[model samples]
Target: MPPKSKADGAKKARVPAKRKLAEEFPPGEVLTDNAKKKWKLGSAVGQGGFGLLYLDSSGSVGADAPYVIKVEPSDNGPLFSELKFYMRAAKPSLIGAWMNSRKIDYLGVPKYWGSGFHEKGGKRYRFMVMDRFGVDLQKKFEENGKKFPRKLVLQLGLRLLNILEYIHDHEYVHADIKASNLLLSYTNPNQVYLVDYGLAYRYSPEGVPKEYKEDPKRCHDGTIEFTSIDAHKGVAPSRRGDLEIMGYCMIQWLCGRLPWEDKLQDPLYVRDSKLRCRDNIDELLKSCFPSENLPEEMKKFMQEVKALEYTDKPNYAKLRGILLQGLKTIGATDDRKLDFGVSANDTGPPSIKVRATFSRTLKRRGRTLLASHNAVCIWKVPPGSWPMPAEGYLPTAVIVCNYRANLFNSAGSGW
Candidate 1:
């Protein structure tokens, strides 16, 4: 994946081309002469509410591959936010370190190729080219009869936890974590990737502690069914929020539906259900899995996460180890192969592209990193209100308030 040559600044003009933010491009349009000649646009591979993804001329929608062109209305959208994130924090260099340190060649993230503006029908749009991914876990869950095997569910949790650690270490929280956002690498089923960072927020500035305050407008910031309690209160994202969201994801993956899945329209109802279930998840587990006890390790992991303050740094290794041990206890190997047990008829590679589009507008989401004067400031949620700790529990909030994170630095040092 190639890096974007130009650096983005506050109020900087859109690069490679600039157009009104509301422009959109349809099929058969060529964004650039260079793009037209090299990476021709194929069919409209996938379409979401505000944007449409097209397969590169050489790429196919249902084929196993590693690249696509994502387009959004130029001015303000998640795709633009994602472009900045990849260009800065989630750069190849950051992922490279994880790959080398973990003795794995790939970090569960898409390879960013480049980004620029495109035009069609006299309107300009923002576009990014990056690795194409195969079927998302949501579709996989639906096809596999909704419920993920316990082994696969545990392994997925472990894998996503490590990815969350890297993103959180870089000072960002993936506000939205769901089955649709988790994808199997098109080229390698053994590797999974976390995509879409539009809802992600910078919790701290490298090392400075951003005070805890909730923003009313930003409340219920993610998918209602799996959003964190902090988000439900309209606060900014933190590492804990990411983990809490993942906890819900893990439960839904194994159980097929969350206890509050049917109550998405009422965020309060969903939030309260999540709160109750978090305390007595064993009963929930018994009902869902029928044969398994509450995964004590998972319960402990969520408990510790809930105890952290808004500005606290998560114990990534400890949290990861909890999930890893769960896998070990189940006698499952971390071969990176998703353990959904391929049946005789399921021998071929999956033949669908996994992309999700949300209806929420970026305009409604408030200040984007693209428009902010200070890269990492503002947007937050309250802490010390999680319904965790039923009785005798102590809180240890770890705050490192004297460091800096270069969020979009191309160099990728301490991202």
Candidate 2:
């Protein structure tokens, strides 16, 4: 037998115990080297094993977006893990060509600011400065009655897929893709960001792919309901696993929950439930999408994802086409708006909400080129939208059509 690979060792990589955040840095503490003054901590906004995320007391850091400081003990938490990802994928120079090629201002990843060491009462701690984001999707989901608008679901899906493609191209896989890890811009609610790289791992290292073997001991490495089958088997995450997790997220977002969420404690059981669902998508979705049955297009998409191998480069365009097509079928627009709230009365033929039934088709298909092809189509006013030029309606549809669609253009600078 060939030398046993140490993939098993990944199973033993337990997170280090988190140190106390409050004990490390009290509110109003200013961290400085005097030689080059850094961040001053404000009130704590959030906490993680990495430490506390606080508003920047140093006015210098908050120019456009609010800057926040993260303080952590050098020995524990995800700050270091975050640092590695930023070093690789966030560097402007490193990703410049990649961004130019795609025509994206930024990869839906978090922005990295300055980082340094801070000492509080003889204890040394590391600190990083980064953009402060608004409420996360988990919070939004709960506030929206655990379900999001259909239009919102598709918009968020493509945004997330873009992030996945960018990260995957860079050799990393965000093993943990969940609501809580996604944040919105305080300045622009339309922009979605992927956060928390603590669980991210590179599927391919230095052009070599990790073997596809599973380790029973390493099963369940990500969120229970959303964890991929490979994760449940303790195998490293790959492109397929990322899409699998995203599929679960989309189902949960549209339906308000996944079939396996109730069994979160037993991750293995949840994983098994997901496997059962995948094996019988028709039945599972019959219960989940009862009105007209689940979108057949999505089922085919899942099949493609399930078919990918550990080393196979995902058919990025085909996978994205599935989502784009689904979005269009739902009458989703290129508009970045969540499409929530009660409809405003328009002079146009009363808003015709064309809800597609199983037999009636609203087909969609497209190129997955994020920068080149304008594949995302916003869910707009239905066919009944025939403005009589009566009410205060703009004659030009461009203004109201896809607000900020230009932001996704290939010629745009970072937004």
Candidate 3:
């Protein structure tokens, strides 16, 4: 028999010991960073697995605050994991230097502002300051009937290629890539930022790349739908893995769904589906885009991802070229504008938000049925048929769960 999942037991899965929920801090609470920079907090804007996010600004924190501060218990691991990547590679100077050298208009990576520790009521918390962002692409994706326009998808692919190349060059691999993790610029909707590095792994320490190795304990270490094949096999994330994940993101963004989305509760099943798709890229495309002309560029992109070895450095320029060519074929250019409007080719109207559900087993009418994982659809079940979070939940239309961090961050960034 297959191994029993966390939802198999009569009781719900217990929250891990180290996953401590953060206490909210009142507005105007002052925090002093190690650099002696004092940041005054606004109201708590968001919360994640083990952290609370507050608004901050040079003057008074308000709705227009330019920065957000993510605070977690000093003992939490997710924030610490993210801070290392930010400090090492996401510094504004580092990103600026790279942009200048590459001559690109802008990269999608988020800029790290500042980070330090704070003490409140004898409890220590870790905090990092970062630029505030606008709405996440996932929200936009849902609004557009769960599918992005073909041109927008290509533009996003090119932009993410720029981001993956930069982080890979810096020796870190962002193990997780999905719509929810991508947020638009607070001031410029055309500029998107990839955020939430809680699963970032330093595949290279110093200049040496880590050899390919799989650990069973590390299996399924990211968002199930978009995680790379390497991640499913328990392998440590690498450069190729980031590109693979990006490819999956683009496919889902354009096509609206994946073959294994309905089986996300079973990681093994999802992994197997991806393995089959990897062996036959054309079939995967045909299944997703049955009637429409196949996205030749997407097929080529998947082939490239399949050809990559565990340690091989991908030719990002070539991948970007493929997506650029795709845009051209569609009579579009990289105009740097993101259009979230409904596509003329969309099969149906956008899904109306009736009720959202989470991944868990529901005892309905004395029969156990597995609720779908992380989906936003018209829930057909009766009222009270679904489970709820212990502390209640937000009215988010869609929720993408991160397996590695067990985070519920929808405001688009820190966890």
In order, candidate lDDTs are: 0.62, 0.66, 0.78
Runs of candidate 1 exceeding 4 Å displacement: 1-38, 57-65, 279-292, 342-415
All candidates: CA RMSD in angstroms? 20.6, 13.0, 14.2
- Tens digits of per-residue lDDT, candidate 2, 1-415, equal 0111112212114564434553545656777632476567777777776488878846543434277877787665578777777767766565566778878765567766667777667777777777778888888888766777666776787888788888888889998887878898877777889988877888788878888988776677766667788888888888899998888887777777677666666766777888888788776666566433366655777788778877788887787787778767765655766553322111121232322222222222433323322222322333445434455442322112223322121212211
Question: How many clashing residue pairs, candidate 1?
Answer: 13
TM-scores for candidates 1 onward, in order: 0.70, 0.75, 0.79
Q: Write the per-residue lDDT of candidate 3 for residues 1-415, one digit (tens) a residue.
A: 1221223321111234446788999999988877888999998888866799989975788889999999999988878889999999999999999999999879999889888999989999999999999999988988876898888888888888889989999999998788888999999999998998887889989989999998787677677777888877888899888988898888888888988888778889989999999999998988787434578998999999899999898999899899889887867788888877643323222322433445454444555433455533321222343443344343232222332212122222111
Question: Candidate 2 regions off by >4 Å?
Answer: 1-13, 17-37, 57-65, 291-293, 342-415
Off by over 4 Å in 3: 1-15, 344-415
Candidate number of the best TM-score: 3
Best by lDDT: 3
Q: How do the candidates rank by lDDT, highest first? A: 3, 2, 1
Q: Model 1 over residues 199-219: C-alpha lDDT tens digits? A: 667777767767778777666
For model 3, name the residue pairs that clash: none
